[model samples]
Target: MWIATLALCLDEDYELIDLMEQMKREAGVRENCFASLGWLLHAKGEYEKARSYVQQLLNEHSLLDEPAIRLCYSILGGVATAFKEYDESLIYCQHVLKLCQKCGEDAPLPVAYQDIGEAYYWKKDYDLALEYEQKALDLLPEEHLQRSYIYRVIARVYRATYHYDLSLSYHQKVLDIQKKHLHENHLDFAAAYNSIAAVYHNMRLYEKALGYLNKALSICKKSLPVNHPDTQRIERNILRTINHYNRKRQYKVSNIILLYYLKSLKSDLPDTEHETCSILVRFLFDGVM
Candidate 1:
């Protein structure tokens, strides 16, 4: 369970899935592997699979009225948040908080706060997000793996608020901890690269953004499942950065027009069309696209 939890914290979704599957087979449905498995699928952007798992857990456990039952609610919140179902996520978070109130200020108390904060963060309410995240940070122990993830969230909040330097500082803290505590080439490291790239992009440091984006893409290619949404996102970021960089040079208008057309196609097309566009774009740019 610790291994699976740690993998999830590090954004190692594939590893978490494998671990949870083995744990479920060995320990059976009596354990909390179901919730962990559901959360892992949510992290992987497999919303339908995650929803089914959460539903199974809910059907089996919702009426139990135990502290353990709160785990089901927490996972429902997580899955909903992954799907951007913020209102539903908040209701589930409230359910978990009510259970925490009944059980005293135990571990889930902090987690409930964090979950609520996550929902707020996704809604672009950075102030409320920071408040709850600080509440969670206060409760989480210094060395817990969850603190690293919370730090990343806080970093993102800072970024969204336009505090770029502060965001970079916090992201650096997360990256340092990940390097110290997690295995090399972990997806969290890739995520850190992507976050920094976004900040650089916003700052109009195109070359720096491109460097971090390439690092992220390299890590995703080696570490994540093929065709993962995360990989596609990074590839899209790379193309955006390249297009932005090209916009400044004279004689680049034709290329820019082509790339802009491809971008429009990418936004409007299905995944199959996007894949075809990617191939065409690559052919036009000698694989740079």
Candidate 2:
């Protein structure tokens, strides 16, 4: 169970799979083992496998009360999110919220709220996302890892709502907390830098955006595998920002100019690599003449 928990938290998929198989063989399908396995699978984005185990655990654990039931809902919410079933995700999160309320202001309340906020964020409801994220932040235990995630969520909501300054503030809060509690090259640190850069990019502060994006790209390149989508995305974003500024010199540019340029680029090249390259080529062509 301890090994499974560690593997799930660290997103070590192969280790979790091996540990789970050994555990199942030794324990003959225990509820706790199934639950842990389910969570591990969920972390790996194997929603079907996760749902199988989670459903089994839910079925076997007839006397499950607030804590255990809340855990099941949380796992289900994650699985639904992975499958892109935003409405289903929201439903499971609502279950968790109810369970939290029933548990009388319990430790799980913040986590439940966080899940709901993430669901709202995924659904593109920035107002609800901010509300739920703030609620989660208010309920979160001081100095907890969950609080870092809540701060990040709030930052995302602020960014989505075009509140770049507010987004940067929340992202910086996450960065400060993570720096104190986590390793320097932690993925969460990369995530924070990336998010801050995104806000800067949206605000048309290309140089500042490039600085943070490059930092994130450096950390991601070192820590993550070469093919990791996040690393690749950040690398492309850095290139895009450089190209964007390069292109601006050729024409009268403003925030509106950049916004329209990005919107047009979004249609042809949904992935970052193609978009960045296309923008760079356009910039070079415009400037060379």
Q: Pick the candidate with the highest TM-score.
A: 1
Put down candidate 2 lDDT per residue, 170-263, tens digits, no spaces: 8878987887777776667888888888888888888899999988988877665546556777888989998887766545543444566666
Write the residue-wise lDDT of candidate 1 on 194-265 in tens digits.
999998988888899999999989988876567877889999999999888776442255476477656867
Off-target runs (Cα >4 Å) in candidate 2 are 1-33, 45-48, 51-53, 56-69, 104-106, 141-143, 221-229, 232-246, 249-289
Residues forming the 10-long window of minimal summed lDDT in candidate 2: 22-31
TM-scores for the candidates: 0.70, 0.66
- Candidate 2 lDDT at 242 equals 89
Count of backbone clashes, every candidate in sequence: 0, 0
